[model samples]
Target: MSKWTTANIPDQTGRTAVITGANTGLGYETAAALAARGAHVVLAVRNLEKGKAAADLIVGRSPGASVALQELDLTSLASVRSAAGQLRSEYDSIDLLINNAGVMMTPRSTTKDGFELQFGTNHLGHFALTNLLLDRVLAAPGSRIVTVSSTGHRFVRGIRFHDLQWEQQYNRVRAYGQSKLANLMFTYELQRRLHNTQTIAAAAHPGGSKTELTRNLPRPVAALSSLLEPLFQDADMGALPSLRAATDPGVLGGQYFGPDGFGEQRGYPKIVGSTDASHDADAQRRLWAVSEELTSVSSPVI
Candidate 1:
């Protein structure tokens, strides 16, 4: 199959999309492309100023692209819920949702909701948001949910069993890997649950992109990353998998998408195989139950 690119977003006319962390990086690129294709893009970000700035940037680029901003802090369930409520009130149907915001490995820290920063922000938060907006997604046939994961997920040992919250042990990079694993697991289980149903749920990973997601790296390490990053792809190029996963008509639910280059690092978007843990249905089901219990929001039965 041909690789998916920004130019092939199916002229998203009349569609409505929500992309988290859309102020910059792959999220911004994704939003800009969707809006340019005629989707009414909503940038749900943590920083209002950056959100407005991103909107302006998209408008500047797309000229007449319809874009709006909604504040969202993925670490806090309260914040995610509030943002979803606002979106539910403002829009009747949602054609796409990109669970793109994330935090990479960093010093052990807790979010406002007391979960590990990485797992909380990257996995659990998107879990809540997807469930919260389940109605809107189901209401709009052909709607899709695209989650951003990482090739780093293969290194993960899967969700921490006893200390799922990472209270007992904390390793920055491992935690990040676990979170990304959770992303794929979530997508697979969601697709399983929505089986015989409609909304598409898929996961994509951007090839090594020079984005702010690596900002958590300490100064010395960051310098090394900067030196190495240029050898990879740019954020706009990196967003192709996400853009394709979100808009491709041939893109099947539960399919994992990523770059097709060396080791899935840098190339055009194409179907890719995820880790074995990602296909663990029992784990996915357990994670779903835990997520619902933690978020206190069950997915809509429709």
Candidate 2:
């Protein structure tokens, strides 16, 4: 284990990788790295214009990188369904489904479906997309589903079972934490469900990478973060954990990857442990059931 980096990613030629939010930040870096390695990369993004630009940049950098774009807005279930349908119709198999897009702490708001914004976009949206595309992923040999969670998952005590949508008192930090925690729980549960299949589920976190995700932070917090920006790793470095989790031949289902530096914030990727709360089997199952009910999407594997 000589520090897992993009160099460790096995040849991905012929593989189809669909990365949500691939237009920028960690998603952009992840897509660029995979495309450079010869994977047919799909930029699943909300803004088609930015996605095209990202695709162009990838092709420009890699010379012959294969990149495509699909319109997707996680805040809208209809958009998620449409994107998944279009993908299914185009690609017979998907080797990698990276749930990499997310919204961090933001003011209380609701999605088109009337769910809290962060929880809706960061957790429930990806949940539905993963289920809708599970068949295609399963069809591919040695496929993988990698969800990008966060170290922020440790900020919350647990999933707010009673007030998951924050209809009561809305704290942006806790809401974001709940969504991230849901991400890890989802991965662990998905791995359990996919045990009989070749497809496995894993998770990764960028570990305080400087990315556009911080745009939604409050003014004072944003100012403070900006002052501390030098301490944060750039998006390219941040993407290593996800790249490793997605393409490392030795990765196991249910494993998580993150930076190996102080506080797991700025170093190369390595297998890391999540909070004890994240490992609560009952909570994971409950969250899965609730996610299905909320999104109205059934798990394809089950």
Candidate 3:
């Protein structure tokens, strides 16, 4: 079979897609591709100004593309709730919920909710948003929930349940790794819960893409990343794994997509494997339980 590309994305006409952090990078590319294919794309962003700008850009590129915006800040559960409520009120069903926004390695900080910034924004934020809007997702036929993880998931051993908040000691890299690992664990657990339903949960990684997500990288790391910039793909190419996972008819629950090149970086999208730790059923469940406790949001499917 030919390698999957944007051309292979099935007709998404009449579908409603909500993509978090759609103002730039892989999310913007994914939103543009889907909107071009006729999906009513909702840009759930933290900044309405940037969101509007992105929407305008998409519409400019694809005349008549249906694009909307919703203000969301993952660091605050209140914002997630507000965004989900507004989305539920406007759309009867959500065909796609792309949990694509995230924070990379940043200095020790807390969210509006007092959790570690990376874990709070990247995992808990999406966790709450997903649960809040799960009903709408389930209402749509053949719907999907796609979370964007990263190759950094392999950098950590597993979820640091003991120091989930990183109050003990802080390490930017490990925290980010835990959050990305949580993303995969959440996807797996969600798929397990949705097994009897039509909606499936899948995940993708951008695989060494040139995007703003690296803005939080420490100066030394950022300098090294700049030195190795030649190996990174552009945002459009970075989005293919996510696009394929969202629209490919062959995709199944619990599957992951990433680049096909060396080190799973900078190439065509293809089905890929995550760390064995990511697939541990017990770990997935534990993370789900802890996420619920932290976010005070329960899975609608359970």
Candidate 4:
């Protein structure tokens, strides 16, 4: 296949896209590219001021770009609900819902709901957001839900059902891996649930891109990142796989997209595969059940 950059993104005219964490890094690049291509992009961020700033930047670069801002704090279930309600009221149909906002290897902490921070923000948060907006997304013609995961998922073998939240002891990297793994599992299960609908579910990874997500990395990891910064892809390149997963007409449900470079890092976007554990249907189902129980938000699609 020829190189698939943002330039290859087909016309997004008339589509409405909701991108979490659109204020910076990969999410910002994703929002900007889609807006430039004629999509009315909503920057669903935790901070309104920052969201507006991102919107301004996008509009500045791409004249006539329709970019809006909406506040969404993924760590808080209430915030997610409010954001979803506001979005549903505004858009009759949502063409794309990108579950892209996430936290990395932070010190052990819990979210507003008392769940593990990384797992809560990265997986459960998006899980709730996507379900809350499922109706709107399903209403839209050929809608797509793209969840952003990471190569770090290889760090964990599978979901630790016994200690899903890492409450006993939290190793930052391991927790991060579990959360990302949950992201893939969530996507897989959601696709299965929505198989009969026009709304499809897919996933993508940024492939070791330089982004603000590294702020929470461990000291050693941070130091290593600094040394390897030169090899990391820029945010725009990192956002390509997500862009492809969300807009690629040929993309199918349950498929994953990532970089084509060595070890699936730092290159053009392409359809990629996930770990065997990630493809475990039984585990995916269990995660979904646990998620619905934890968040008390169930998808009508299921």
Candidate 5:
């Protein structure tokens, strides 16, 4: 079968999409393609200036694409709450929520909330945001939530429940893996909760792509990004799996999508399998409960 592309995305007219960290790279590409296809795309980002520029670029290319900008810093619960409240007031319903923003292997640091940067920003932030916005999403017809995970999820064995914040010791790669694994677990658990609802939850990954996410990696590993650019796909190509997960009509709840190329790196989007660790039911439930407790946010379903 031929590979799926943005050209296959159905007419997204009348749909409203909220994308996090959409100022550049894969997030920008996903927003641009969706806007071009007639979705009213909201670039939910940490940087408003960059978000506006991204929105302008999408309008420039799509010639009147419906695009808007909203500020969101996932590391801070205050910021997430403020953004969600504002969004809830402004938009009556949200058709798609793309938890696309993330941080990589940065030096050990904590968020404004005092949680580890990666775990806080990548998993906790999205988890809270999705739950806060669940009402709008549930109200919309054919709505979906697509959280972006990564191949890095395979690096960790499982969610370290006792040391979720990496307070014991910091292995940047391992922490990142735990966060990505949480993303998948959250997706599946959400799907289970929404089984009776119209809204569906799915996950996707952009395999080996050249994006600013690598800016936080160690200097040596970061440098390898450019050297491996020939092997790595560009941001637009990398955005395919996400774009597919967000817009594809045939997609089912709990499905995970990724690149179809060698080693699942750099190709068209296809349904893919995650690591055995990512599918742990007990882990998923525990993480969901722990996330709610940590963030002080509750899932709308329960």
Candidate 6:
């Protein structure tokens, strides 16, 4: 397939999009692309400086691009709620919801809510945001919700039902992998739930791109990662699959899109497959229940 770049993006004029973690990495690229195409991009980020800088960067690229920075910390429920409510108040309807922010292998850490950092930020936070924004998303005719997962998810055995928090064994990498897998599972179930509804939900991954998503790693580990750049796709290239997943009118619910390359690592965007474990209905239901319980948020007005 030919390369997919932001310049080639189809027109998204008048559409409003929300992208979590829009400050850097694939998230910034994704938001940049959408904003370039004339979509109003609400960048939901935890850091005010970085978030505003990202929005300004996008606006700089596209002079008339509409970009807003909204404070959001996925690690905290209070933060998420305030941001969600603020977003609702700002825009009557959200045409696109991109759950793009994530955390990685850090020292064994947890969110303010005490859940594993990876699981809380990557999966639960986005899950709650999507559900909370369901009203605006569904309220818009033919809207979509896209959750960004990772190829790293393939490394996890599966999301552990009993120890969802990983309180027992604290291997950061495995925990991160499991959390990403949970993201994919959440995407699957959300699409299932949106069946026959106006909103469509799909999942995508940025092909092994070098980005700030790895900031949590140790200095030594980070230096070792430089070797990955040559082998990994660029962040803009990596953002293409997500852009496609988010903007492709042909995209369907439950579809999984990613780079079509060796080991599913780095290449152009295309629809791909997920592991069987990602298809577990039981686990999805459990996750939904646990997410609502943990976040203490109300069910959205779907």
Please report, in order, the local distance difference test score of every candidate based on alpha carbons. Answer: 0.89, 0.95, 0.95, 0.94, 0.94, 0.86
Under the 3 Å rule for N, CA and C atoms, how many clashes does model 1 have?
Answer: 0
Against the hidden true structure, what lDDT does model 2 obtain? 0.95
Worst lDDT window (10 residues) for model 2? 2-11
**Which tens-of-lDDT digit does each residue in 43-105 have in candidate 1?**
999999999999999999999899999999998999999999999999889999999999887
Checking candidate 5 for backbone clashes, the offending pairs are none
The 10-residue segment with the lowest total lDDT in model 6? 1-10
Residue 106: error of model 6 in Å?
A: 1.3
Q: In model 5, what is the error at residue 229, expressed in angstroms?
A: 2.4
Cα error of candidate 1 at position 296, Å? 0.9
Residue range 12-84, candidate 5, lDDT tens digits = 9999999999999999999999999999999999989989899889999999899988899999999999999
> Would you give me the overall lDDT of model 6?
0.86
Model 4 clashing residue pairs (backbone): none
Q: RMSD for each model, in Å, please?
A: 1.5, 0.8, 0.8, 0.7, 1.0, 1.8
For each of the candidates, give the backbone clash count: 0, 0, 0, 0, 0, 0
Candidate 4 off by > 4 Å: none
Weakest lDDT window of 10 consecutive positions for candidate 5: 220-229
Poorest 10 consecutive residues by lDDT, candidate 1: 1-10
Q: In model 3, what lDDT does residue 106 have?
A: 91
- Which candidate, 5 or 6, would have the higher TM-score against the true structure? 5
lDDT of 2 by residue, 186-282 (tens): 9999999999999999999999898999989978878888897899999999999999999999999999999999999999999999999999999
TM-score of each: 0.96, 0.98, 0.99, 0.99, 0.98, 0.95
Q: Model 5 off-target regions past 4 Å? A: 223-226
